[model samples]
Target: MLDVLPIFSGDDRITRLFTLVPGSDFEADALSAIDALGGHTVPWSEACDGTYDLVVAASPKGDLSQLRGPHVLLPHGAGFNKSIPHEGSADSASGLDPAYLRRIGHDDTPIALHALAHPHQVARLAATDPPAARHAKVIGDLTLERVLTSAPLRDRYRASLGTGARKLLALVSTWGPESLIQQHPGLPAQLAAQLAHDEYQLALVVHPNERSLLGTYELTERLAPALDAGMILPDSHEEWASVLIAADALITDHGSAALYYCAAQDRPIVSVHRGGGELIPDSPMAVLLGRIPQLGRAEDVAETLRAYRPGAGHAAAQAAFAPPGDAVDRLRTEIYALLGLTPPAHDVAARPLPLPAPAMRVPAAFDVHVETTAAGFRITRHPAGKALPGHHLAVEHGAADEQLARSAGLLYRRPLPASAAPVDLAWTADGWTRHALSAYPGCRSAAALLPSGECLLRVRGHERMYAVQTEPRPERGQVVRIDPAVALSAVHARLLSPQPAPESRTMLNCLIGERTFRIVLRPATDTEATHVI
Candidate 1:
């Protein structure tokens, strides 16, 4: 029996495959997915330490070296377009060379299984000279299979959107500076104005990255005009799928939204683009743009909608990319074959996987008491306090090591000053690092001043430190209290001077809520101060 570990990277669309692994009889655990997203599952370090026979990843990137067995890469979304140009294609303008793409965690990691979404992707990989191409195999689109098989779930989603008798239109967005929403900021409200509210219902699903940058509350407020016009914004991946199923027509910038919606629902599509040119030449977006009506202005959306019909691109999309109906079974077969074992006899019913819970933003109320010890300062949490499980206690001090919170909330060592420069006792979760901070709001900022009067900044709740300074330095022994509530809101900081001097060491001001704090810095000097406060 092979022990399989399915690694999920917070993309809820990818985690949909977890629903199919129940009856496989392979000792499979979803520790990686839980780690990538927020959940109280097995820790990633424990899951990766030779505990499983095989590791399956949703995307082609990630650190899979810890596994002693072969790893499998599954397509997280519609992999119809080649992310990088073909091996020697003269498209250097896209900056997608094989080497650069591979280094950035593209699907070209050797010694791994590359499961293609369709035969077209297999052919595309075969044409490349990369070693990853040799491991590529067609496994079909598992997400599409999940969407198509679940009728009741989809209906519930549609009903929740109030799609009673009106046609639904989903406007999907992607990341990057050149993404659809970035290119046309006014597209959502513009499209809403063109469609009749009584006859048509509009739904918006912005990329999770974009949503994170602007924040859910901020994004919703930004799109209040559309929401007031009866346009629904699906907050979760499940709701997004419901909008896709209910949508009679789809309008998207050249992202996976075009391919997945068009292929799965056979819906008519309108591809939007900036007037300059296509983002990716000869991509699936280009193909869809050529087949469907391309819009450059919001004024043209209504006209294009009138001319387009449902399932107009079904035949062409199906012919170009054949998405299999039995993708889940195909994936299971591939897994068994790779392990040289017979397929287990089981009826794996298509069940709905739980949607990920939204991240918490405000710091939880905790009863923290500080005590001084010989080694350092010790902080303890009262038994009656409440916090999200798996949160590690991180101090704002630059030299402090993160301590995991025990059931009794006995966090050992490092006491910060109660009136010190906004020393934050942050509750950080696993996988809430600098790179992945946009997804979680709870651990966005954790900054504090050390005993030496040097400022230590932790952005997105990660341990990466930056030395910042403010003009008019605080007295060496004065208890300068930087408000934790205010200092955590600074988005970015830069040292204005190369050298840290009393006169020149000033930091660009950061916003703490409505207030701005100008921090000053001095070179990190040795200090023997025992207690901070």
Candidate 2:
């Protein structure tokens, strides 16, 4: 509905905007969004008493016979891939379900037009309910096209999401008992616990129906753990389109998001809850699911995420839509014709998705395990909120273990204040000893990670603390990337080793995730380390 608002933005003579409340199962949900759009909402009883040029609605549920007007039925999702399981008189195609379309005793569809997004829907409608098909028109998918149009702003979305250079794995679930969120409630946090937050980003895309069904307060509380472990949830349903645009891959169920994202992105999808196939068997989604991979609770998330690719059948996914990038133009033409007016002379193009403003909470504490290997350094980090076991605890300022006594832990600076000097970004471990020891009982090492790919380290047992920062000199033609926390953990492993490396050697290798960095080590005094270590 938000997608089509711009078409009516300039129409002055259309006068009052009155939304008919036809009592859908998700009526309040629709009304809330309509309320956001700002309009006078009229209930069905009152709506039938008045006449208008045209009326539009997304859901076909409930009795809309009392709503008198030339009705335009819009696809709330990607051409209804699900069956109307509970629409009485046995299940039927969701969008063209006949029983919900006509007046209680009448045979004809009250809707003047059934605006579909694909040719396939028109054909399906014709086969299942010829009356609805007579009014169905393929106008392309306005939402999907808008997402496709926003491709050029992918980086912008990534920035807004704060995912940085990491591959974003989006967990998209629709509302229902069979949805992924309902089946595996902890998957988001569990999947995130497998990899360091710095190496990969995870987010949950929930259907508005579920959010409305459970109510925002309850749904947010349900996602508390995932949110605390750095997973983001959009502020509103409309922001989800941009989330799809920013995703590198998808972990989806049998929802419309899976269908639309498959069409817009070439990235692979790992289907969760595939067993409950309530899918329209011949629908594009069902066909795509047959070719895509399914994930079980026992499957290795990291391995699947890194290895799977949406190989082949991309054309099949695209065929579900009525061409791309021109939905706004096509939809506007159909709607204007219904309003008995010319679609303003100017050309129409699908606009970029709205900027996503999501509440993203990062892990405040981590249980880090660092090992010295011949390959370099192997580092693993898990959030403290999870039940996973860790040998060492690394806590931040406001983390759960922030006040816990740590005999041997690594302590680092928190995010710098706005007034902090640029040099404050990196400070040596020795000078930080006072702050670290006071903060953590057995603080052995401290580090200040820098934005310029440098880490200033101070190991207490070493002779004099160094004030110099270490810079990487990648092995010939190779680029060095550093995950600061991982880098600090690697340095901790290096310092606490059974047989430490010879201090005389100034150069060493450190590995984090799959990337290796060649760092130069040096010996410096605390005063010299004040600027950087």
* TM-score of every model versus the real structure: 0.53, 0.88
- Writing each residue's lDDT as its tens digit, candidate 1 over 1-533 gives 01112212222333222221222222232333344555444444555543344556554333444434566766654644434334334443222223432532333323456676667666655555355567777766666665566544654555556664456777888755666668777777776655533345677777765766666788878877566555677754445665676677888776665675666666567877553332455555566666777776776776786666655566445643555666566677777677676654554434442332211221222233333233222333211222222223332222322322222121112224454456665432221223223433444333444445444443442233444444332445532333331222221212212323233334445332222345543323323111132
Least accurate 10 contiguous residues by lDDT in model 2 = 101-110
Model 2 C-alpha RMSD to native: 3.8
TM-score: model 2 vs. ground truth: 0.88
Model 1 scores a C-alpha lDDT of: 0.48
Q: Judged by TM-score, which candidate is best? A: 2
The lDDT per prediction is 0.48, 0.68
Which residue segments of model 2 deviate by more than 4 Å?
15-22, 37-40, 43-45, 104-110, 305-309, 385-387, 398-401, 404-408, 419-432, 449-455, 467-481, 499-505, 525-527
What is residue 339's positional error in candidate 2, in angstroms? 1.9
Residue 480 in candidate 1 has what lDDT? 32
The regions of model 1 sitting more than 4 angstroms off are: 1-51, 80-112, 151-156, 275-279, 309-312, 340-344, 352-533
